[model samples]
Structures are given as structure tokens and as C-alpha cells.
Target: MASGAEARDRLAQTAMYDRVESALNLVNERKSGLTVPNKWAFEARVGGSVSGAQLAITWSRRNEPEATLYLNNDVEPELAAKTLLDRTYGLIAASFADRIIGRDGARDVSASMLRRVANRLNELYTGRFDEIIHGQSLPLVSIDHLERAGPNPFLYHARTGEVLGDFTGLVRQALDRLIQRNRLRIEDVDVGLLASLFRELFSNTHLHARTDLEGALYRRSARGIVFALRPVDIPHDSFAAGLPVLKEYIESMEREAARPRVEFLEVSVFDSGPGLAARTLRSVVPADLPIEREYELVQKCFLKTYTSVSNPAHGWGLPRVMHALKSSGGFMRLRTGRLSLCKWFPPGMKDPRVTADDLQFMDIGGGSPKRHARVEGAVFTILIPVGLGN
Candidate 1:
């Protein structure tokens, strides 16, 4: 492809994702019936085995040589899912492999088996997630979800993009499965509360995070949120070390139970955008301010009064999230800029004044005076104690 001085064409020219043109748009545009512009086209073919049942993807670029990148066959579902998942996230970073065109079983499986498949991919790409404070994707999509596929009480409520629906839809699907799986173990959950928690997080991303659309920078890109929810053993060495509250909670849980069985939900919500403060303060912050003061000001985002979005209805998102988690005794680690803020909302302590006070601050990657190695965008981890008091 050639770059022509950033011409803003009416149609954003990209490629076919599900592998070719004329395939079901992965990113459905809903009721208006307008054709969603796919940066890449994705199409899957049905064979003797079945169309929706077996999908293989061959990502192609216009004017460039074409190759069958991957195809999904029922015989090897995990491999098929792995192939597509690898391609999607990989291409996301692997130089413009966009567009998905399949409406077959591959779509169902990939979306359905998000946790099982994503966890597997995370292991393949990022090694075992159990050892880290941040698990890449959660609600753990895996091949198991596909193998034992059923109506697990999880449903796609809404979507944000043609590829993955909206951020809320993505979060709902993951949590639904997590809730479903936990039930088998006879553990009850507050489904409504969980849904609210995810919605608020999605609102943050929708409002604050700038999205990446095949290397194109836009005020808001419809790249649906990437998230996950997986069960984790409490008191992991790395986690306890970083989060002060984790150690205390573990000790309390153990003291109560003679034989403790502590399970924690590792929730991952990541957005590829500038730091919260930078994106929010793009216009608010003056160009020539000293870096430290600038950093301090950005930290004020959790407060309702310090909102960046002009909409009146939007300011309450983060504050509401904190209240929800606090009511449920949940904890979260928020990473942005050079600050890694961890704060657990205890069961009974209610802080009235908006959020910041609820978090403990740290510099994870490296810097001084509010600085270090910074994340390219924003990463948030919500830790919910499953079956603890519910």
C-alpha cells in the first residue's frame, strides 16, 4: 500500500479480514443497516463439514500478494481458534492485518470460546498468566468453553465495533462465562453488580482512551475493549508484594477458615491509548507546564469535578465504579502514565469524597517525581473475591 499525504477518503480503504470481501461484517452496524467499513475483510467458507462450523481465515491486503493465513476446521477447533486469535492480536501489532469476514462457527467459537482460547493464547504469547499481577485477558476464554459449548447464561448485550461489538458486550460475554463456570462449583455470584462494574470500566475507555484503527489515530476508534476474567489463587508472591491489601486479606481469610480455599477473580481491561491524564488533558493542560505539576494534576482524574468529558452524564463513571467495588470488598490495580495505583475497597469503610484516596500509588516501570517504564496506554485489573461473602 502507498501513503498519499493522508488523504481522508470517504471510505477508509483497508483490507478483507474474515479473509475476503462480501463476508458477514464481524463489526455489525446494527439497525441502520449501513455497511460497516472494515479496515480488513474477514470471510469464512462452509464446506462439507459446515460453513459456520468450520472457518479458516486468509487475511489479505489489496495490491499486495495474498496468502491463506489461517483457516478453522471443526476437527481441530482449538488450533483453528488459536490461528485466528493469534492472527487478530498479532496482526494488531503485526503491521496492519485488519478486517474479519466470517459469520460461521469460527465466529461463534472465537467469541464463545474467548476465555479458553485467549488464556491459551496468553500462555503461548505471554507465558503463564498465573504468575503475574496483570493477566492479559480474563474471564479466561479457552477451548473448554467451545468443547462444552452451551447457553451458559452469558449473552451479548451490545457491541461497539464491527469486529467485536461494543466494549460492554465484550465485558458481558466474559463475565457471563465466569459466572457460569463458578456456579458449577456451587458458588453464587452477584451478576447484576458484576455487570455494573464492567460497564463503568468500559465507560472510562469509551470516554478517555483513544482507539487504534489500523494505525490511524482518531478521537475515538471503535476498537472494542480487550478484557478477561480468570480465577486466581490468593497470596501469590508477586501480587502480595505489590498490593498491600492482598496480603492482609489473605491473612484474614486464612485465619477464618481452618482449610482456606481462597479464589480471586483476575479481571483484565486494557485499552491502547495515551495515559488517562494526557488524553483527558489534551486541551486542558497548558503546553509549557513543568512535568511534575502536570503529572500531579492528571492524578486528579478520579474526582468528579476534575472530569475531562464535557457531557454531564459521564462524570460519575469512575466514582460509581469505586462505590460498587467498595460495597463488595473488591480491589483493583490501575496502571497509567508511570503510576501503578492499587487500592482495595474494604467491606465496611466508605470514603465519601470521590476516588483517589481509595488507591495506593507506586511507580512500576521507572521515573521520579511522579515518573519510569510507562505503559503505552491504560491497563486496569479488577480483583473480585468470588464466593467470599456472597
Candidate 2:
């Protein structure tokens, strides 16, 4: 053994290196034998590493050893450091157990122990691991419970057990409320029409678009239907292909309205990707329309058939919305290319159908610049006008 001074210096250096080495090893050994309980190995990178005194551990989710007990903290005191590490492993085990055993899924002592670890972490480090250990939403049970009850008409996606009101039921309620609020006659309200519209929109999303994409159909009123579709993937096609049918649809809805008052039917669809292009806009909608109308038309584009992967038979989504507006003496709008348009018509107003020389098509001949066009996702919104009897 060395003298007092020499022993102190050697001891300090060894301990400091040992702590760092342990942290580094922990990082490398993340969850390496987690399934092997007796051989459980966890890695941690202690922050504020020192050569002599004071040890501070700062870790992030990235350096977490196992996929399960993923947590980081600034734990102090060397003895407490080991305890914190153990607590972390316990929390991971608990989370895993809560997922499987508590839910009646799987069973493994090690796995069970892992869950117990999570519980222990919650109990032991309640003050230190509030957000890190347990999230703000401490769910008593997993959402998967709802998923298990298949075909249960009353249950939804495993989380909200069978909605007392299903989508269709919600649509009916919305229609009833709208009718009463707007003083619309029972005969005047078209439940079948609304349902057809809602189902049609959902069908396009489910059958054609990405399977993971989600859609919601809601009846805003007796006269209005709202479709909230997400992750809309736009096809690279000319918008002109769908415009004729869209124009026709709008005209038809207008012709079917009760009074001369304006009614609106809107559909909104979006995606996780970027927005659409300017060149597409120039070729698709009538430029003379106002901002909101332009926005609506651009949004309505993807709802048309040629755009939908499913039934390519009748791509009348856009025209249906457009025609409905025309009948109500309202207008059509198209929003694309970081730009928007609103095209309106007065009562008894004739269709514009302006010549190529007109302001609507002044710059419509050639495609807009390509570099300016980024491959972005698309959002489709369709709004129809309806008339309510006073």
C-alpha cells in the first residue's frame, strides 16, 4: 500500500474513472439481458462527471439502454446513483407488466418483474421522476382494451368503449339539431343525401388512400355535412380533369335548394405532408374567383374520383360541391399554390364561361414554374350552399 497522500490521490482518480466507466458501460449495455431478470443490465451516463468530488448524472431518452425503462435524470450521491438506476429498471418492468399482465395479455416472471420495477420507480422516485417516470396522462389501462372488443357497435377504437352514438348516429343528431335551429322542414332536410355524401367521402379515403390514414364524417346540420379526412396524399394529375364534374355537382345542389338563402356544405381533408402547388392551381380552378372560393375549390380537388384510388367510375365530387353553390346563387373557390380564390354568383346570375382572352384565363395557357412547385401533400375542402325556409 502507498503512503497517505499517495493513496488519496490514487483513490480519487480510480473512483472518478470508475464512475465514468460505469456510466459509459451502462449506455452500451442498455436493456441487454432485460429478459434475463437475474442478469438484468442497464446503462447510464452520469452527468457532471468529476475526478474528485460531486457526481451529477444527466441523461436523455437517447442513451437509455433498453427499449422499456427509457428515462434520464440528474441523480446525485454515488449510493443513490445505483438506486436510481435500479428504480429506472423497475419502472420499465412495471410499464411492460401494466401493458401485458394487467391487461391479460402475456406472462413472464422477468416481464412481470419489469412492471414491478416501473411501480417501484413511481414509488421510490416519485419526487425525482414525475414527468420522466410517469407521463402527465397516467392512464390506468391501455387503449388496446377497446381494440379487443371487435364488432361491438357500441364501442369505438378500444379507448372509448362503444360510443352511445355512432358516426351515423352523430350525423342524425346533427341533422336534427340543424333542422330545428334553422327551422328547416323535415322533408326539406335530406338525411339520405347527407349519409351518401359522408359514406362516399370515407369510402374514397379508406379504399384508395393509405390504409393508416383516418377520416371522420359529421353532419353539421340538416343541410350541411362535414368530412374531416387526414393524411391526404395528392396524386400528380391535372386538376382540370375533375373540374367539369365538380361544377356540375355545385349546380345540382343549388337547383335542389328550398329557399333562395345561401346554405353551405363543406368537406375538409388534410395530410401530414407539405401543401400543394401553384402551377396546379393555374391549370385547375377559375382564377377570377375570390380568395375563399379558390381555397374551397383547391381543397375539393382531391375528393373527385380520378383523384381517389377507389371507384374511378363517377368522379363528381368537385362539380357536385360547385353546382350546389351555383344553385344557391353562391360561388366556387379553389385554394392551391399558397394562393386562394373565391368565385361567387348572384341570384339568377348566368355562368361566366368567359373566353380565353377574359381575365380568368389571362395567364392560364402554360403551366406555372416547376421549381416553385414542391411535392407537398394535399388538403381537399368542399363547401356547398343551402337555402333555409324562414
Candidate 3:
């Protein structure tokens, strides 16, 4: 086995190299020339994928297309390049989105246009998550109880623009350390996935729902930061479908004891706000869909972007979460409406059978009546199976 020091070194090197490559890739794509004073200089800066994934970008402006350029002493050879690139892209996209939408509350643009901008930001930051850590070494550790928050056990911190961007890396690193310490073996865990979900939910709250509640979610405790995923009561059908999928997952695990044993899986997410219509509730989780497929829909929640936040330049968490859950044998269960939106999964998917009632009701639309829920707050519950894929 590699010594801890050796492992740490290798990991750091790999991450750095990745950052360098990402920076170079961005440069290769957009080779813009810059004029600084009269000392015309040219630079071909590069960033590794690690840096890019951390939302870092590097660039060199040249007096000429091919003039020799010198990196300033102020710049960290690696980070300066990546951060510059990432920041440039963010500003450009935000500016464009703002212009099209009319920063002064103009409704001149279509929703689709806004979505494109949001996806752009997601692409930019998704890769550069490491940039936020500033080369700090956080040894991997895994523990438990990262989930659960009284009635609502999830984190929600609504911040705007630069503040949001500043925290992006910090939040990602913090969650990374948290998951590392409480490593879940039965499922794949990633800070990007969790951060994306939390960010999206928080953005929605700030844009549409009640934004006054500061400590509502993502509360800092002596133990650490805590996010509460509350279970709101939504409409429900007498019939619940999708129990079979949970049953099958558990049964399959029991049959394959070699696989990591899962303690449980709990998913709590919302699409629409309260005061949902009866029709919306009845259709939340479809009745005809199989239990497993129904669960798949819940998993899809994270896949959705665009309207989660009013701004198109900033929605990506749900999709990231969806991708993360796909790898592990984990799944999500959701219920949306005035009754609530809830999801649950357990390790190995055994014993606890999803009853007919649990499998019958399917609310395909969450609380969204005609369009995206007018009330803009969402909640999610992410439960990882203990002792699995830590």
C-alpha cells in the first residue's frame, strides 16, 4: 500500500496536472490577444483538468499573436491562469444573460435563452471546483449522520453573484471533506453533486420563495455545517406505486452479499411550492409507472436545470446529483404537491418492500401546475448507504 504521504503527493500532483491541462484547453479554444502598457508580451498559459473542474481558467495576453510573455510574480503559475479564465467566462455569460433579460426587470427574452446561459455557468464551474481550495490538502475521511434535519434535513443557503461564486469552491471543499470523513460505501459521493443540488435549491429560494430566512438551511453547528431537508405535506393518492423497485433493489442486494451493505437511502426533493392544485397532486407520481422506473424519475430531479433558479447562468446542482446517484446502486423517491415530495432508499434494497400503496401514486409534475411553480423554493433529501463505496 502506498504510504499516506506518498498517496497525498500523488493525488496532489494528479490534481494539479489536471488543472494545468484544463487551462491549456481553454486557451487553445479562445486565443485572445491582450495589450498591457507598452511592454507587449504574449503568453500561452495552460490549466489542468483538475483546475478546470474546479472552475479555474488561465490565459496569457500577448502584444502579438506569438510574442513571448511573462507571468507576473503576483500570479500563482497554476491558479492565476485557471481563475482568470473561469472568471472571464462567468462575467461574459452573466452579462449576456442580464442584457437579454434586461437587468431592470425586463421580460423581453424567452425561458430557453436563459437556460442556455445557466448551462454555460454549470459547464464553467463544474470543472473548476478545485480552484476554490487554493491547494489545501484535506485528507479524506468518512463518517455518518451527514443526513437528517428534524422535519427538514437539508442545507439551503441563498446568496447572489460574487458571494455565490466565492462560496462555490469553499462549499465544495467543505462537503468534500465531510463526505470523505463519512465515506459512504454503498454509493458514490461527490462534493460537486451535493454543492450543485444545494446551490440550485438555494438559488430558487432567493429568486422565488421566502428569502428572509437566513439560517433556514446550511446552519453551522459545533459539529459542522448542517442542511435540513424538511418533509412538507403534499397531496397524495390512496394508491402508491414504485414500491417494487425499492423491493427489487433490496432483494438484489441480499442475494449479492458481496456488495456493500446499505443501511438506507432517503431522498427528499420538491419541484413546486405549497397550495398545489388537486390535479397537480393527483399527477405528481404517476400510478402506472413501475416502482423502479418511478424511482428513476425521482433521480431525474437533479438532471433538471434552467428554471430551478430564475437566472439561466446558474443552475446545475440537480443534474449533478442525478449523475452521482446513477453510479452507485442508489436511487431517489419523491412526492410533490400540497401533501409533499419525498424519496426513500435503503442499503441492499431488501426486506422493506414498497407496498402497493407506495407504488400506485405518481406525481409527474411535483407542485408545478401550469409552469414552473410560482413559489420558488425546493428541498431535497440525500441518504447514502453506510459502509458501501467510501
Best by TM-score: 1
After TM-score superposition, the amount by which residue 85's alpha carbon in candidate 1 deviates from its true location, in angstroms, is 2.0
- Whole-model lDDT per candidate: 0.39, 0.30, 0.30
Give the TM-score (vs. native) of candidate 2: 0.31
RMSD to truth, every model:
14.5, 21.5, 22.8
What would the per-residue lDDT of candidate 2 be over residues 1-390, giving only the tens digit for each residue?
332112111112123223433443342333221111111111111111110101011111212222222121223333332343233222222332212221111333345444444454334323232222221111111112112233222112335433222245534544454444443454643455544444444333222222212332211100111221111012211212223333443454445445444344344332211123222243333335454554444444534333432446546544454444344454333322334234444444466332222213111112221111111223234443434333
Q: What are the models' TM-scores? A: 0.52, 0.31, 0.31
**Per-prediction backbone clash count:** 52, 58, 105
Model 3 misplaced regions, further than 4 Å: 1-163, 166-188, 211-252, 255-260, 263-310, 314-317, 339-378, 384-390
Worst 10 residues of 3 by lDDT: 36-45
TM-score of 3: 0.31
Candidate 1 TM-score, C-alpha based: 0.52
**In model 1, what lDDT does residue 206 have?**
49
1 against 2, candidate with superior TM-score: 1
**Model 3 clash tally?**
105
- Candidate 3's error at 221, in angstroms? 21
Model 1: per-residue Cα lDDT over 1-390, one tens digit each = 213212111111232211211222211111111111222112110010011101111111211122112222322544544443442232232122122223241232223444544454445334432321122334221111122322112222223221222344534445555445443233344555666766676667645434332233532121123333434344343435333445565555544332345555544454545557666656323445565665565556666666766667677667777777777667665655544455564554455434455533443222233432233345566666656543
